[model samples]
Target: MLDQAFLLYGANGYTGELIARYAAAYGLQPILAGRNKQALEQLGAELKLPVRVFALDDKIAMQQALQEVPVVVNAAGPYDFTAKQLVEACIAEGRHYLDLNGDAIIYDMIHTYDKAAKDSGVMLLPGAGYDVVPTDCLALWLKQQMPDARSLKIAFAVLNSSLSRGTAINTVLKLGLPGLSRIDGKLVEEPVGKRGMYVQFPGMKKKLFTMSLPWGDLSTAYVSTGIPNIETYINMNKAAWFFLKGQGAYNWLLKTKLVRGIANAIVKRQSPGPDKATRDKTNTLIWAQVSNENGNTLTANMVVPEAYTLTALAALLITRKVLNKEFTPGYQTPATAYGTELIMEIPGVQRGLVQ
Candidate 1:
């Protein structure tokens, strides 16, 4: 029964702005919000949408903000600090929740809210963006193909080299942390970037050096496909790999509160994100290969719009679904709640290109 308009918290962030404009084009007047008064005002002025400026930690402000919108889409990253507060507020206010977060730790922690969310009669769906939408849908499709699959591996070959400031923070939040894998149906942490391989993305001719990275799939894929022993990789050059590996050695530095503060400050000062030309020109190719103990393999890939564009599309798509009379409350995985064809609904999403 939550029928108010959307509250797009963190609406001035890179992906948040894209979602805001896309929603406007869809005839939605979402309330723009975030901690920065200047950025919020700037975005509100351009979009002509109402702005609500408030810090995440202000419970009264957050609660009042939630009451103004039936659903809230969080575009903030390093969601470690933001997601919990907003989600809790949504539950308290009887508002639905969605976000662009892909941190496995956050995803795992959020799963604990399932019963509370269901009791509140509102959905609390994360991984609603490029972080897990495309990949999660693909995992379920592979499961449909090979129901007996025992292991799964997903590789991300983001044809775009430009990492948005938002994504950089998401990456930095877990930097130096061990990679995660679901082994025999339980989440396990292993040294990330410990090994490497060459993976030829389906749409590409040449192979790229793919290194292990802890992605959201470490948790969501299991809920979607029940495939144990999963590993997600990202295409990276030697220099990127070197920096990633070096994190393990210098993790001591990353653990310091001062270093965390400095990193967050650096990210805040970064440009909002790539330009329109950059988003249009770049494609994100994600490949997933699933196999059973019998050696039968089901492999495929998806060629989608740039990560930010896809995030906007996915956000809109989910918002529409959440607005329907028939809603599935509680914590939900992308594919588990919507099925494998979810990404197909997005504009410019190409799928099933096998290697």
Candidate 2:
């Protein structure tokens, strides 16, 4: 045995459960953990794995749990609430920490702990999933083609996929947030959808409209490639784009606690995530372009499995590598630690230069 055991907090969440169910296939053992005792017990029995039930606030219990594994995969979202606690504990305990978060702010916060993580010989990797892995890799790949690139743009689109309840609630919670981008090597905030474009992703028949937002790449890609200006966009239909532009009018309402509470209540009543059948049919598309002052540019495109599916695979893949002692001892994005080929390791991923 390779002693491939690790701790998986929030193991009852949609993405976490998916990772737990597939841990065996990856030749790893995950000790399921979370606050929901009932859910954790059922899942642990089904998966035949050890179980640890403790809320993130239960510091003593959490620290005791950390002693069972050398790595922790956090599948909990709205990472703004969960990341700080778990990351701090991981650094203190010298355990590698990984999360499937794509929030730019969260990435920046984690980066601030780089020195502590390095000093502790702990690897802190955020966005170890769909949020940034493919795009981060693509960004680095495009940068490789244009080593002197001054600007970078990356976009992603999901086809035939639906959001998990956790993802939906997180979206509602951030409804009125401003967009973010990196300019002149600094993070800048601006109106959401401040920039829009049409992208013809690989294998797609037609172009899709995309709007720039504060994606995790706005933070992580800059670390991976010192591109001075980086922008990230997500595909949206014209109607959605129009509504997003008009959101400023109701931004205040969306930010109110009452509206957010109602939104979350509704989200909780829905399905947790796409069923296995839907995940099997969905595809994720990503595009990256890099340009220099002289107008030289290179574009790359990639197609991968559904977002949630890819999240599960990528999170576990990175976990497996960490257990095998194949990781750096500091803060890292997927591409920064494992290189551009990290995305290619997923079974259904394909990448190529744009023609």
Candidate 3:
């Protein structure tokens, strides 16, 4: 049996630190666990919590560290490299697993372990972050409002400052990669930046162009709402899109061994963006428009904080639910596991249907 409160893996990373602070504010005495002993110690001292050191590569150490913890929040990102090991450890220990994974590949990989997790009765929920939570939860809410909806479209727009090193590295690696999403009950390859449309968002009534992307929430929502056709769009400025278009040279660089060197240089030289002023000025908009056979449409809006913080909060909230056995074992999304009613209960969130 696991103890009531256990650990937060990767508690030393940039986003991990934010999660630690948020967890502390929530009155959770989570054991800070990560590879860097010094960084973990520094964070623990700051948060006034005990520190535990365990590298993800050391399976024995990870298992031993998690033995007494009933739940573990994997705040680590670029989860492609870390999710599997942590999930395996949690399964072996019957501990609940939660991650703020936005990588679709990682989500698909975790979904493969659904049967194993179910058999062991360990809850596993990935993408408990801003990427999927707000959008997926909104989709669930929209479906409930329009039970006859057969097809749906989600457009997500975030106005914020510069990108983080981890985000940049991940994006560079995934550039030009094909995306997959279920369309009309078939798995289809989504063309990067191929689809675009203008849609109105709350507060800002102007229509903005949105492009199709592979968001894990769509897959989770398909199962949750049984909606036949689903599509997700990300709204960004034309300048960003043009910048993304100019990344051919960067992609070539990533294909070589110099990627790590280049990434390190960029991180050292670049300043962290979306500063306090930028974050306060920024806002996230999620629009889910559902249409039925009769052509009736319903739209809803959601406000999200800076991407990383929202993801951390959503993951933390899901971790709490897993601890209380409020969710089921096996692969699921926050909206699917917690339900829209519970998801909307989180503070700083609002829900409404567009007339």
Best TM-score goes to which candidate? 2
Per-model TM against the reference: 0.93, 0.98, 0.89
| Model 2 vs. true fold: TM | 0.98
Where model 2 places Cα greater than 4 Å from the true spot, the runs are none
Candidate 1: the clashing residue pairs are: none
Q: What is candidate 1's lDDT per residue for 1-355, written digit by digit as tens?
A: 2353688988888888898989955556678899989988988898788999999878889888887778899987769888999888899999889998887788988899999999999888899999899999999999998899999999998875477887877766665456777789888878777668888786677888999888888889988888988888998896878777667678878767788778879987888688889899989988899999999888888888898888898988888777664468898888878889889998888887474
Candidate number that wins on TM-score, 1 or 3: 1
The runs of at least 3 residues in candidate 3 whose Cα sits more than 4 Å from the true structure, single-residue gaps closed, are 1-4, 239-264
Model 2 has an lDDT value of: 0.92
* Candidate 1, residue 75: how far the Cα is off, in Å: 1.2
lDDT (10s digit) by residue, model 3, range 1-355: 4434757887887667767878755555678898889999988897788888877888888888888688888876678878999999888888788887776567778889999999989888887777788877888888998999998888888765566656666665665566566678555775555566787877786888777777776677776788988887888676666665545546555556576667656765765434557765676778889989998988887776767667667777777767667879888877778888655656667667887
Clashes of 3: 0
How many clashes in each structure? Answer: 0, 0, 0
For model 1, state the Cα shift of residue 232 in Å. 0.3
- Better by lDDT, candidate 3 or 1: 1
- Pairs that collide in candidate 2 are none
lDDT of each: 0.84, 0.92, 0.75
